[model samples]
Target: MILDDFLIYNTNGLYCKCGDFYLDPQVPVTHAVISHAHADHAVASNNEVYCTEATAAFMQLRYAKNAAKVFNIAAYHQSFVVGGVAVTFISAGHMLGSAQVLMEYQGTKYLYTGDYKIQPDATCEPIEWAKADVLITESTFADPEVLHPDPVVEIKKLNDISLNIMLGAYSLGKSQRLINLITEHAPQKTILVHHRIMPINQVYERMGYKPGKYQIYGRKLMKQQGGFVYIVPPFTFDSYARAKDVKRLFASGWKNLQVNKQDTLFISDHADWNDILEAVKQVQPSQIWTLHGDGRHLKNHFNNDIFVKLLS
Candidate 1:
């Protein structure tokens, strides 16, 4: 393994000195190589932003004229030069236009996986594997015991319940995925999405992703007794916390989010333990650098087999 730290994490997120750019920077920077359009990763007002086409669109939709001074959009696998480094974007499969940033400088390859998942997602691009010398990964669900159940089976749980369900999900990625899953698995429940989520859904549809059938949310639906699914953002979901008529279910992989709620739908857009292991195998990296979540489990698992460095 190379002795040099190809990438480093600080308050500004992942930085590449060779490239003179930040990878999914927390704060706005002069040159930002965004991995996706997620709020945390793709902040507005960057001088020059580099990302995929879909990511650009989402950013434009969210931040409007403030998205960036210049959008250097690149397709998946296309290599572009930023200072001394050659950068490439690979599909991350977490959400639409999400990518794993691959930076190559002085013969060494470093891959920064920004919120990736290996699970099949119809709403976004599938994760692509590329061999790299150093693998910078997210350890969100790195614990060995945190294996996520099959999403198909999890979504099917909605079919068993015939009540009006207030389903809470993130508007950007999770909501779209849930709509598709419900259409395929729980066809009996009519889909009602919040008005705020409609623009994003339209973006998904225009991008050629069919998220099945869903209508804009209406207050009248809440008066109904059964047979519908009201999909809303977290804020709206929390607002209806006291509504006693509908069954509450939040789709997420985090246990903390599922706490105090009996109806659990364990759906995640991040890689679980086994998926992380598989990503390591696919990347074929000699050195591993973890961030975003706890990396102690990975450090213990790799032990002497591979070098595991926690960036967080």
Candidate 2:
């Protein structure tokens, strides 16, 4: 097992004792190296934060009351040293400004893949890989047989159906990705999204990752364009009075989603088992640490040859 104590001092999030910083810490700290804008990974009330430019902007939008006291912007592949530890950010392909953090100290290199996907996405940066002595990865979809279906197939489901569709998705990364997918694959359908998703979309556009055509959610627009596709945040979907003719569908890859046959669009933004394996092959890490989901599948799959540790 050979765990390097100095590189990872796991208390709150993945803390780096050498750097005196936390990677995506849940509890606020003096210095936090954030991975992305997702609510869970990017938290509020930190003395100083280091993340990609888009992630910093997203933090301000998401946590207005207690945003990061200081935003240290780091572009992709940008390397900087913190307390003698070399650090760099790699495109994580999870969402806008999502990144894989690389840290090197005392001749040992480590990479923490914070919620990533290899499958090409239209709305954000593409995934990039590099070798590391140790790799900390997410096991969101760790089951070997749980390979995700092509997202385009899910978008086509809406195109194939004739009824007005009310698609429920998370407002941040998933919404923007879905809009671009639908527009690029099913261009014939008019797409309308919730008010919450508009500003994030604008951020993506400013970063030059513009999504396809979509208007903010409006009852008048839906009435004018009879069968327009309405995309709303999962929580707010019910608040909007459902039109009699509209079919409701929730987009996610979770198996529980299938319980209700009526409304489950199997689309996801996180990496599946196959993507995880590919990342492992690319990084070729001496040791692998998993988190964020049931990591049994990944640990079992690579049991014989590779060192797989479950970091609860």
Candidate 3:
């Protein structure tokens, strides 16, 4: 079956015609099936939002009164009907509440994988696979050369440095993951988190996972010692680019974002090339649809074996 006939990309996002809803709509939508709470994937203006309980909590934390008018929360592997089509939420292993939306219509299952990771992380749920006829996956790091190194090895690099470190990471998922990694790997360095990241961390704590011990950020704390790992959001980290007395490092898989005098920390929450291939093998889809990044790699790699369609 041609999945594109029912699932397609519009200016808003991937719209499911059969389900009468949008998957992670880019803008305000009437019926939004959110895959996660990332700013890019989940918005506040949706009229009806369907997602996991954790995602709903994160959205409420981030959006407050402006959040969706109605929330249809579902748990992992739970199935529900939307506009006559069966829909299920599967763990994507991207963050606290990330999910892969599985829509079934006329006996054909289409899986839309949000940003996901296969690497084991104690902070969030591990990736779970579901069989589907069509697999819609993200190609953020689909190139064969883009293999992410072990995050424990990457975080251990902090122990080798004696100076105060200004680490940049996304506040929602990456920040919490870094805290866990640092505490587990670099026991010598103390963790300090920016004020903006505190609420998200609290959400993680409420969900029953300890993201490691960390104190709130203070200028005095960073200036007082050389053994502190001060974690801040990207803007704050970039602002201190000219400041002295600390080493600047950004924890990410993208080489472009790892610009600093110090060595890069190739830590990512998204699936890399090998992980994506593994997901493809697990899903065993008749057709592959790619989005969120370049799909040429997957399309080229699958050449004649399976149909690879680029949605973006």
Candidate 4:
């Protein structure tokens, strides 16, 4: 579908717009606006790119030279114009530097939400809902059957489960979210983190989220903490016997589903079905386009007035 003179294509990339930009003629447009630095969402090769400052730093570290052309914008609501499109950015709450891009052309406003999560987390700002004419959103956890436990409740459960319990999650976003939740809900207890999580923890700290006493993964540190919560990657759980002394919990958006029998905990960064409904009601957009994950399931739950398109 076309909006005004802008042409939207379901290219082999996350989200691409083709118009009056000249940098990457091979792709679609010159001014590429990105939602986050996730490998699938943002490509550093794009000549002129726009994303949050933290995302830019991450891209710079990953693809040094390619990141030089990036234009960094702070996560706090900010507006800028590119190619005659008045674009404003807000936090997506998915990662340290994730953002939702809102573009206004003439009088119509179009909002593109890059993978977002409504549940509050310490790793990033809470997702911000905005009203718009066209709302493009992510449906990563759109099924009603998927329901995440309340952050506070989950933290209490995790705390009471065992002293030497190890939680498995992604090193970047999920780790910080779990750590922050534990800090807020169970501040008295010192948390232990794996060495891989240290870098992202530093980034989160720079973003003003200071976690409580934590220890990085090492033989010496692991031996010292027999009753502390150790946050590690999901892959670590494959060799459960290695951590036999500690109980294990797997945290992810997928945990909301009953597909697995393993001890799964529902702690996700993505918005669940309830979050999607509320966000749609809050935004009240005339048109809604769903992207990523199961969009059709979410589309069926909304009102008929809102146009829904699945961008697979």
All models: lDDT? 0.91, 0.84, 0.91, 0.69
RMSD (Cα, Å) of candidate 3?
1.0
- Quote model 4's TM-score: 0.84
Distance from true location, Cα of 213 in model 3, Å: 1.1
The lDDT of model 2 is: 0.84
Tens-place lDDT per residue, model 3, 65-131, is 8889999999998899989889999999999889999999988999999999999888899889999
Candidate 2 accuracy as TM-score: 0.94
Candidate 3 is scored at a TM of 0.98
Q: Global lDDT for candidate 3?
A: 0.91
Span of ten consecutive residues with least summed lDDT in model 3 = 1-10
lDDT string, candidate 2, 197-277, tens digits:
898888888889888899987777766534588888867775654546677777888866442475468888888988888
TM-score of 1: 0.97
Cα shift from native, residue 57, model 1 (Å): 0.7
